[model samples]
Target: MVKEVQKRKINKEEEIHISSSDSSSGDEKELMLKNPLKWWSLQGKRNPTETKRITLPSTIKLIYVTLAFVPRLALYGLVFALGQCCRAVAKLFCSSVGAPHLANKRILYISDYMPPQVHGIALRVSQYTKYLRSNGHEVHVYTCCVESRARTSFDHPTLPFVANPFNSGNQISYTAGIKLAWALGAESWDIVHVFYPNALGLFVLPACRWRGIASYCSHHVAMDDYANRYLQIPGSPLLQRIMFLLYNFLYDACYRWPASYWGDVNASMTQTFVKRHLPLAAKYSHVATIGSGVDTQRFQRRIPTNPDLLWLWCDSQCASEREALCKRIGAPTNAIIWLMVQRLAPEKDIHIALDALASLAQQRKKMNKELDVWLVIAGDGPAREGLEKRAEQLFTNDKNAPGRVTFLGAVPNARLPSLYRAANVFLTCSRSETFGLTVTEALACGACVALPRCPVFDELYGHVLPESWRYDADDKCGGHLALIDAAQAAASIEASAWLEANPIDASWSAAAQDLDRQYDQAVKRGKTKYTSLRSYVQKRLIHLGRASLLLVAFYFVLSYYWRNIYCAAQCRIFLPSLPKPVRALCILTFIIALEWCHC
Candidate 1:
């Protein structure tokens, strides 16, 4: 009775209600195996191996475009463009945005969008915003509300959007650029932080420079995720090339563009980011490992319960895969409780989980044993329908099956902590994860995890958990059999026994503490930089003080000269008030003057 009560308690804590979904694990593996750079080259003929020189035609085109813009507009553009070149100098002069240690520093937090979007990058952005603001930094977000499948109802009130380009196919980015310029001028910001070099970030970059604000770029993902998630399909090679160029351009902008760092929070993701961008990024910038952190307080274990033989799976792509894995493991019905929590996406490879479960049922039938198990699913996704259809077909066909699979879709994040507490084990079947934040959350909740040996699984949890808690899909059938054997052995060894044999509470606490320490260190580092910048900017201000009057006079003279040229041109074009030869010579000389100034 005590064991059952303990099992029930663990179930309540760790039970994850995931939605039904189907995705191909095979496809995911294939995509993972390919070298992203080579694949990138194949898709767009981008020469990652060689330094492609910018052609004179491109430079000429840029020059001509600059000449076409109004002189005042051009001046603003030049200031912004020049700022990119002077970021290191600017940082030497003023505090960069998001650098810790400057009190009351106004930070312009630029990102594509914040959560509750289905995208991992978006969620990370949201978390960063939340933590930064909570820490008392004055932060603001500017992002495009583009029509995407992932956007949810969560809004960062402090970080409000100026506009959303969800419907209009027109160039929405241009409008954003105009708005960004206005924002930069309106506020006194210490630094402008661009999270990614996407459309929005690229657009506002110039505005940051024109304002003489220190800027930063956070390379948050491996460059490959962009190709796989956004640039899908074999065609669109030109777009790929353009993206690569833009990434390179942004890389050149920041004083120091930090890659997601390994051995930090989201260590696996940081490591992956480094691996993907190191070839291109290492050349120009100091690519350091600054990883995203988790709020351990929010995810920590709330109640102590004896660990049940709980199978907690999250990933909308895992339904079919989970079924297949259960069949392989031959877990009896009612004996095992398999929980699947995940998004419904083809990239997630969740169908493999379902398929694995179904296979388990077939094996149970052959043995003439009732598989006493419960499969619970939680979450929602795009592939919900197909996955549901599959679960219906598979389970209905199995007459001897004694177990039932339940779907509990889309629970609140607050509710998830309790679910983690109830479960004994966590399962992740996704082939790739930036860091698998949930996996760590489960670990925090004291749920042992089972996953393919992802970078996170291998690096973060390998030493902490038993060998039975992990498996690799790449391994042969024998290897899988070994995993099954280990899992079965682990099941008999009660959670209490496991805990006694391998103590991890101290390690978990230490890891969490270490994360906090890193956060402190980051803040300290930021402060030092900010102080240096403030001092430099103050020095520059002093130098400018002596020449302020002279510069003011020089500005008026330049403005008047341009005004006269504009009036003369207007008179020539609009009225016959000016002589033809005089108008023509005036225009020619004006162009020459503009060209000389540009030079």
Candidate 2:
């Protein structure tokens, strides 16, 4: 009887234990279903015996799948719908306006400078005007009167006007405003395109608006950057802020406002420039990137079998003839020539190239390798004298010998093709370049190019050129090392093969077609709806608000720091002899003078 009772108790206890275990297992299964991510993460830690296939409920599984894809599906759907809507609107607008009819335009190109300026903007204007005329468009240019010697055959029909006495540069001519306005009033123009928003553009844009003519402006240089570089202002926070305010005010008044108020489009040479420098213009006008193109057919490789024969060809007076000038200069046939074709300006960073070359020469000597390397600089500017002196100091040595570096001065455009072809490697170390025309020309001529790692260079060649061709110019040692590597690569058999494969399309015809499309778009947008008076009023208010804010900030800074500044100015090292009272009076007087000037 006792044994029977013990057996019954054990069986009951076992049943109870089993029930509790089953309940715990059910709870764990529910938890796993609720948090599959956690469950999966912890799955690897579980023993093989403990592992089991998890059978989730159909409702839960469906919910999980839906959650995973619903947001992505909705986002994709929205994008597709927006794209379709935009396409439909554009198609409808084009059809209604008969855009195809306005294919060939009567263009009036208002430029600050033209050919013979020997500047990038001038070259771009000349090329664009020439190509536009070739494409069956009647194009006329209005520019300031230049010297008879500075004029080109292409300048025919280009109306030149007298400039103001106070003009800052050869390009800027204040008096051209009146002539431009008169010309616009008399003529019928389909489109008025301003190359640079200088004094000329300010007048031309307003005249185009008054005459109800479509207009556009091309952003060539970043004025703020130029000011910062050239002004030699101390890089203090207060000074930088003040400089920024001044630059912004000038840019808005002279360029942005005029372009936005009167012009239908604002074009930039590169997409990078359009994004970085023309944000305000972009907001109000149809911003387009119509990059300057290269003459690819003319700039092809011509490796001559005989150097002397090429030299003879170079000496001939045939302007149309192509010949390798590098061969004529007695550069070694086996030497790797690194060529630079750029203005010798401070901003161009020509000194960096020289430094790299010096370093390369030293490295070659140390390695006991044949120092068959040469650097050919092919342009001139204000920095030429300094650069030449520096080059002479660095390169002209008894052991290494001279002629390692050569200055070709400013080579003509007609001869540039041959110059580019003669060099094994073309290099540019410019700190800032909107669109590197020389770099593109070099690449088109089948020369391997080595560029400093800048935004412009990256945009131009990061995808197309090999990684070995680019170097961080910001690093001194790295830049020198990169130049050495590039020279070695250029000398190798693989360089020619690489150049043949990676041909960039940089033809003027392609650029003209792009511009044509932009012109049509600009015209379409201009005709659709004129800006309302309310919009103009809003813009004026915004401009006023910005000015007021800047003024207030300036006042606050002056008021807060005037004492410190005054004390600093009156320090023993600077103005020790002056009395404190007199110094205080002087500071007060200066402040008053500033206020008077402001008024």
Candidate 3:
């Protein structure tokens, strides 16, 4: 009974997660990769990579789209200036600081999200921590209490768009500031690495400054897009206009609130970001390792499965176990398993896959083709219930869907290999992935993939996956069918050749190595203040500006809510018996109280 309880407790904690390097690090290769514009040459194309734009409400589109980037630009300026000054100071002060001690360093990770939260940040931290520990690093994870998935409900309707006022998306641990402040002060750590920057991760920046520790702020997600993505009201053209108006307020609240964006070294998940906009991110931006190192090793590792086929699972035995896996997941034994492993979030664009699958079924019927394809979703999120309903609606309404939906809710990390091995083709309708760990895992299992026509995917897989493998995300009507067809084509190609063409090298140890280099640099530099008064003055101004920005953001949220509440409620509080100013003040106070209560 105790063992079973412990097993359940363990199951409650584990969750799915997060990146990729641009290219090889050979001196010439590094130079070529550093200029992401030339990345097209690598993918057997001459065209440069381009960033996709997320359309926002026109009210603040000018500010959010045009002016919102100004802050990030200013941040980049600060980092570059600080980096140059810091480098010179380190050279002068610690010229004899000697080689960095890559091993046995004390590390502290501050994040609101941690394993077993089933988030990419949690898994990224877990995997990297394991690598660090194995290499003799003493690491401590400081995070808020991880809530159980069962305790949370993911059954909310998505069409009308229920979301946070700030639009950070769901499943965030908000109460951690006091706990993290205490933990940072208690530990005499060498390095503090932050996984999620929107919350407690931001607290580490100042704490590390005071403690004189090296700090790293990882930019895992492009979060500004979340408001527009999740809070989308697609019912009517008028509803979409209202959605646009609603998101403008949400963006105002979220923009300057994130302290992680101001860190000296921002680690990006992909090198494309570094290449295109922030060149300095290269030093901190590193790729997390894929499962095990070798493709064979990944398949060989499993949990509570058939022991005889454990080692050589990816070989011939993978096919034999496919039938059993289908049975386990309630999928048709003869069905072509199309697996999508990700948190079912609005940003994931899962409905696109469903829609595409529905179209594929219809097209196949029209052509009299036989394809029994089942989309096996292997993760859960706040959007899961809505997604399930959407799938159901698609199946019922379309009727020609090739196969039914099989939701294997949050499959344990260990069993992912089996699922991947069983899957005939991997499908991702999400265009928002930085570099999906699932994509790499699927390829390792020798499965074909259908990728969206997003810049990140194009750069990462453009060279490897065939031209037909790409599908238009913006062109949603026939795009999904094209993606499905591509996946089918991929399955027909030589597996060995396919794996070779893929740029699938993400060593967790290599990520650790990058961290070690940063650690050594920070240790050697110590906590020296910027020597130049001019730079110091610039810093103070920027610091004050950031504070002002925060206050302005708070004001914006308050003012927007105040106006909305007053208008929406249709308050007629102008008392003729009372003084005009007094009545105005009373109404203002009431609005403030209402907004606070809502918050």
User: Which stretches in model 1 have alpha-carbon errors above 4 Å?
Assistant: 1-105, 116-127, 144-179, 185-191, 203-216, 219-226, 229-268, 290-298, 304-334, 476-599
Clashing pairs in 2: none
TM-score of each: 0.56, 0.63, 0.59
Model 2: CA > 4 A from native:
1-103, 145-170, 233-248, 302-330, 476-478, 531-599
1 against 2, candidate with superior lDDT: 2
lDDT of 2: 0.63
Worst 10 residues of 1 by lDDT: 1-10
Residue 134 accuracy (lDDT) in model 3:
76
Report the lDDT tens digits of candidate 2 across residue range 57-170: 322543554464345434434543454345334433333321334557878777767766676777777777778888988777777543477454434334333321112224
Q: Which candidate do you rate higher for lDDT, 1 or 3?
A: 3
Q: Per-residue CA lDDT of candidate 3, range 328-421, in tens? A: 6555677777789997666777877777677778777898874477778888655665666667666644445523676767788777777777
